[model samples]
Target chain A: MNLFSIFGLGGNSHGVRKTESSGKEEHFTDTYILALVHKLRTPLNAARWALDSVIHGDDTGKEAQREILNEGYNKIISAINTVNEILKAAEMDSKDGVDLKKEKLNLCDIVDDILKTLGYLIKRNEIKLEYGDKCNPTIIFGDREMLDLSLTNLFDNAFRYSPKGNVFVALTREGGMAKLVIKDDGIGIDKEDMSHLYEKFHRGKNAKVVDPNENGVGLYATKKIIEMHGGKIEVDSELNKGTTVEVDLPID
Target chain B: MADFTNKRILLVEDDNFLSELLSKKLMESKANVMRAADGEEAITMVKANPKFDLILLDLMLPKVGGFEVMEAINADPKIAGTPIIILSNLGQKNDVEKGVSLGAKKFLVKAILSLDEIVDAVAEIIK
Candidate 1:
């Protein structure tokens, strides 16, 4: 849908040019809207990037500062989650439904690409970041960007809470649906937190370890993105042990 | 070498407050700063003084847009190679990609960055 024609008020309305129908005004206005959207999203993207950096322990062996690095990473993630919630509230139509441009995508390849871009984080944390080869070029129908962002948030979370443990990402096919599994041996959530995991601003007890004002919204946004793609997310975890998040997405 | 110290920079932005604040910051770097609230004035000013070392552009402008200004500058030989860095609030992957492909050297999102960061980016790019 051309958001410009739909969201923009007509020329008859206020400062808009009605007589000069060059579409130049419309085009320029559309560009401005696009720019504004990007402007607003950049900070969120930066926060995600910054968090990923801290979680994956991208800095040199500054073992003494690991605690600060870990806390900073978690705080950045919290900030990104907060921004995502704000965007979700503002982009009304976008939140409820996602117009996923589905294509035949290889799940393994996609995960590889995401990890490669984020290699710095993986290497810095000394955490193992690898996917099972069984993924087998799975074809799925979903918006690539939405899928990537969801995966990024999940993997990022796994890496942050489990800095000293291995982070395993695996993909499996079952019952005609593809499942992406991200597991981590970090500070897993208590059973109590799982109930409100998908609720915006709901944070676990350990969330305060990162920031005092923690708004646990990352999983919520990730859940929305997944559901919008016609997928389901299930979490199985135990405090102090590990957590596993399984995303079941349709194969197109 | 072309001296960038006294050279003027054309900043085209719609927001008056930001325009003034940014101009003041850039001026502190010893560069004579000129303001164009819209694209038309930007184009006219560039045409008059093609010697500008840099063009700090905003993606959103009133009359003419940043891309249009870029097109105009790129079409002319005099200011063709002048460094053009996008100082915009638009930092989306696609938007930043488009600006760079259209000759913008760097794209900075305004909200996440401060005036000092902008000045530093300008200094580094111009240098």
Candidate 2:
């Protein structure tokens, strides 16, 4: 974070001068790129490690090899998604941003699809998963696929972080806006992590210390999608307690 | 002959497939493994069952992440002295340093390390 050039401390101080604003912008983008690199490498590492394990284990059986192949495929897909997210985040810096295919989409339908996809894990983990009555067929105006992905990331984090705890999700129409409240009674996040939570490649300290597939890009991309929909996301968390994320998107 | 006949071990991980693989391998070694899918579960299990010979901790978990789990384990007077080996995919110096600082005995990255390497480390430490 120390950009000596910003203050013209060590860059041609005698004759030429560096514009403070330009230097600051450069420093900001530098940090952003560093984080983006980290995000890209995470999925790459997963794919590489999976491939390496497959090779190292020497499992010759058809079933064993097939399982490894499946793992690799998932890892690779994850990597591709990460790349697309990074590209999308970069595109957001432009005035055009996201050209979302806005449509009438049911919030319940999207949530249910994601839940059904991950139902096995939810059941196996003994989690008390709930999508309350408030979530009953709430309609929203937004890009269906984009909202689906954004909500998926939100739910994914909620479930991944909670260890045999409750995941409560509710979609309600407020006075003027639609609200999505997702609360998890798992491990909470650190206060320091909140500021950078939406940054392109910022993972909380505690989040990085665990053995789950967490790419920092998920939150970033989620934030981007929300912003494109003219929505807001807020997080409330306490260490060792739990986290509640509330996303407010516009409605018809 | 089983390498760890009746030895009790606690495995902390979030990835289901990886956890299953390790659990199966540990069972083959004759070690009784109790798994915790997240950091909170690991801390709770260690406190509730202090008799476990070893705690295999994973850093990236769902609810309670790994460092907090280690700190919680040490915070509990009853299980304060439980032996914990850090296991996670976060292969960075800061992560390893933080885990060690939280009283974890050793750090093992899941991505680079093989099952045999981890198993051997566990055997050596427990023996």
TM-score of chain A of each: 0.61, 0.74
lDDT of 2 by residue, B1-127 (tens): 2398878999987766677666766776889999988777777778777468888987767668778887777777787877889886565677778887887778887656656677888987788
In the range B10-99, model 1's lDDT, one tens digit per residue, is 888765545655675566567888888777789899988857878899876655778888999899988787788887766678878888
- The C-alpha RMSD of each candidate to the native structure, in angstroms, is 18.2, 8.0
Q: Give me the chain B TM-score of candidate 2.
A: 0.92
| Cα lDDT of model 1 by residue, A143-242, tens digit | 7766776777788678767766888888888988999999888889988888767654355776434322123336766777788778899999999899
What TM-score would candidate 2 get against the native? 0.59
The CA lDDT of each predicted structure is: 0.67, 0.72
Give per-model TM-scores. 0.45, 0.59
The DockQ of each candidate is 0.03, 0.17
Best by DockQ: 2
Predicted chain A of candidate 2: TM-score: 0.74
Residue A247, model 2: Cα distance from true site in angstroms: 2.2
Q: Please give the distance, in angstroms, between residue A50's alpha carbon in candidate 2 and its true position after superposition.
A: 5.4
